[model samples]
Target: MSTPPPRRASAAVASPTAPLIGLGAGAPVLAFDVGGTDIKGALFGEDGHIRCLARIPTPVAGDRTGQAVIAEIVNLAGRFAEVQPSVNPRALGLVVPGHIDTRSGTAVFAENMGWKDVAFRERVSALTGLPVHFGHDVRAAGGAEFRLGAATGLRDVVVVVIGTGIAGALFVDGRPYDGDGLAGEIGHAKVASGPTCACGGTGCLEAVASAAAIARRYSALTGAQVAGAKEVLDRSQAGDPDAKLVWKDAVDALALSFSHVVALLAPEAIVVGGGLAEAGPALLSPLTARLDEYLTFQRRPRILAARLGENAGLLGAAIGARELMVAGGTR
Candidate 1:
């Protein structure tokens, strides 16, 4: 093992104006959020501010995808070091999509990225010569929301990211409930029948409720080849019949899935985010109404939109890095 850098206590303290408390408030840190197409990297300084940030295209290396990503991370780290030579990072936080096993520090599977059982934490630590914290991207974003976004102070909440695919971060009793890193696969939960999903499942929640699903279904129904879900939403508001039908189905599927979650977990809040969440009230109002239809005896959760925007996952990764030095994170 390589020699570890000199340790320093974390100095991050959550402030009212900012969602993050003490980020790289000590020995500095590197954080990365790896998406299927892009990788976002940031460096945090002793004062907990982002000292450097960059986004790079994710390499398409087939079976070598994992190695390629690790190389990119190393390159980003070196770039940050060049930009801030005075800082010596003590830890690195990394997050990626799909099923994750944080306990094992592995990417269990990511269909889009074409990788499985990739031990990211061990590899990154070995290459970077620093302690590495690994996590799921959606869950990391949810952590940011829980500590610094919409669900702050909520003990029981579900932070659902509704972009290309639907996934969730489960918080129970004010602590993240990872279920061994697979508990938040709410997207795969069966909702309807017919129409196969990318995971080879039929009637999965993500197949019907996700932003990608909305656009795909609308394009199929109307044969109009819309640009994205936002366009479909706009058409629906403009009284387009096909767009309305697709949008309603998407909302209904979401409500059905959310109602099941409410019945099982009874979360105090359901914080929605990601590309679809940009619809704001247009999405939440109808979903809430449909959810109410299914919840006759269960407690209705307050459905709120995420406030942290696109940077939540990166911020959460930074939090994971800072947690290595801080006694209690989000303080």
Candidate 2:
């Protein structure tokens, strides 16, 4: 696949007003952000505003095969097209959680969704009859952060999302470093010695610091069902010892992982997103303090919260689709 031209500098930097939206003029594009639990989609108009935003549960449970997932996305696109007859989507951008080989437009692996080596771009394009651009979900979100949200104006940065799982997307010298679908698996990096991961690995960072892991660990310790990580944080604030311990562990794990990133990549900032980041000061304050302790001489990067919220991935897909149009030798 041909590489798209570099995004315009304005497109790569966040604007003061509505930073999450891209800044280019192009034909309207349809975008899908496929996660483990849900699929969020939107149609981005030439004026850089999203329309017909929708969210639906992922078909992972109902459809064991990857084909059904693709079918559902095509169905959603059809619905969007039907709703907006006046606006035609010139291309489509699809992003999914997994090890994605973007060069081949293949979703190489996604343990949560149970699919591997699926040709997502080809399938979606053939079904929708529009040019398609495919990307990894976390990286796509990071792209949005880099170009239109938290990490804008930074050349070297790490955009980390701590949701049901943890992941990072690296941007060095104003370009995303995908590393053939394996660059930012920070969630899988070992941070402890015991907790087993869904990937059949022990002590992975995701097993400790992910929002899902925090709730799971807290529930196991108290033998009580909690709503989610937010609840756990609230419990900690209320002086629950178990919640405090679990939260501390998660913060420690994140600090350790970030220290490694700082040593290696020396990023200017680490822009954090996802459910856990909703803790706001509760997460950032301690994380910053702990991270400070870990860094001795390394250039400590600023830790900041993601500004785009949940729609970052969708906006990123739109950005990729617009770039794809340019790459296809069109507008």
Go through the candidates in order and give the C-alpha RMSD of each one to the true structure.
Answer: 7.0, 7.7
Error of 2 at 91 (Å): 0.8
- The residue-by-residue lDDT of candidate 1 on 275-307, one tens digit each, is 999999999999999999999988889999998
**Every candidate's lDDT:** 0.86, 0.86
Candidate number of the best TM-score = 2
> Candidate 1: worst 10 consecutive residues by lDDT?
6-15
lDDT per residue as tens, model 2, 199-275: 88999999999999999999999998999999999999999999999999999999999999999999999999998
Q: Which stretches of candidate 2 lie over 4 Å from their true place?
A: 1-23, 61-64, 329-331
At residue 268, what lDDT does model 1 achieve? 100
* CA error at residue 297 for candidate 2, angstroms: 1.4
What is the alpha-carbon RMSD of candidate 2 to the true structure? 7.7
